[model samples]
Target: MAAPLFLLAPPRSYTSLINAMLGQHPQAFGLPELCLFNVPLLKDLWIRASDEMSNEAKTRQGILRAVAEIYGGEQTAATVKMAQHWCAARQELSTGLVYQEIVERLHPLVAVEKSPSYTISLERMQAIRAAFPDARYLHLIRHPVGQCKSVMALNEGAFALYVNAIEFLEDRAIIEPQIAWHDLNINILNFLAEVPPELQMRVRGEDIMENPREHLAAICRWAGLRDDDEAVEDMMHPERSPFACFGPINALFGNDPNFLSGPTFRPHKVKFPSLTKPVPWRDDNQGLKPEVLALAHEFGYQ
Candidate 1:
């Protein structure tokens, strides 16, 4: 079995675009956010959760679309139904096994994937290492201010609420976004410590967006894939990924819903926000939390 590549980050990072681009590499197979780790059982994915928000449901869309395209050769309702059965047949297997099966099916091409939810817990990441001890891990980082802003923009920060993405929960009960940024990133940092440096790497999302061709070539090199002009050309068309657009109705998402609506990848410069400034989300121009600032410095923001 091929050693898989996993992109780890909190949600709303430029993970979708980066993962798609890397997947489009001639020697790689980018996959949708399978989100398999979120649940222990495959049926749990289809089981209606109490949250009722349907966010988890979006995770299935990628697999459905990929199955439709890779196996069924068309993304139609019927193909999506076939994808469901495909998942059903492997309902009892571990997520890592299922992913390996998919990668093997695409033989010789490296499987590239990013599932932000994997960062929610360290144990989940450990499970990945245990599954593919030789697997390569990419610890993709985004500035807290930028990441939190993007998170808040999506569904009015419903994801933060969903993940209980709170940082400083003092006895007085003041909820702070800065703390959320600091702590969540800290979670990622600490978890990454256990991963061997040889199998792991890090990249700033902003850098990739600002200088895609260069940074993408760097990423390709890191992943042991070809970084020639042809590979560079293929990476430029992330929009060409099968999951770049809306998934078939039966399996509508394994990616950002916003991306599903408009998943075009255009190269553009990204501005890094000043950490010293007050965040725009709060009614008041509240500055970042002290802890958040400390964490930002650890991530080399200072």
Candidate 2:
């Protein structure tokens, strides 16, 4: 079985675009978020991680869509139904085994994936390494301000709230996405510490957005894939990916909605906001926390 390349990052870190871009490589297979590691068993995907708004349901949609596309060779209502049955058939199997089966099916094609939820707990990440001892990891980072802003912009930082990244003020607990941003990155850093240096790499999401061709070529070289113009050009057209656009209603969201709405890749510079400035996400207009700034700097951000 081909060991896969897992992109590790928190949500809203350009994971969707980057994953799609890398997946479009001629020698690679960009899969929608499998999120398989979030659970110990294949059946657990249907179970909530907690009483709060865990992303298991939405995450299952992505896995189902991936199964539908990879197995059914199509993602239609009927295929999604088939995917449900597909998952049902393996409900008793270990999630790691199911994941390996997918990797086996896509052997020789680098399976590029990122499930931000994987960073929520070290156990999820550990399961991945245990499954693929030779797996490669990519630690993708985004500036704290930009990442937190994007997180808060979506449903008032519900993901942070779901992950218990909250701060208690005098009276109420408000979502603090900066906590999630910092802590998730830390989780990735800690996990990567145990991985062999040659088996793991890091990239800045902003740099990739600015110079996708060069950065992508670098990634291709590192992953032992083709770095020639032919493979590189294929990666540039993320919109060409099967999962780039919205799928049928039954499996519409195996990816980000913003990405699904406009899956095309535009090579433009991302004007990152200042780190110390008042963050737009907070009504109090607080700047980044010291911990957030420290991690951002460690990631080569200002």
- The TM-score leader among the candidates is 2
Best by lDDT: 2
For each candidate, what is the lDDT? 0.78, 0.88
- For candidate 1, the lDDT comes to 0.78
Off by over 4 Å in 1: 49-53, 167-176
Residues forming the 10-long window of minimal summed lDDT in candidate 2: 47-56
How many pairs of residues collide in each model? 3, 0
Which tens-of-lDDT digit does each residue in 8-60 have in candidate 2?
Answer: 99999999999999999988899998888988899898866443234557778
**Candidate 2 TM-score, C-alpha based:** 0.96
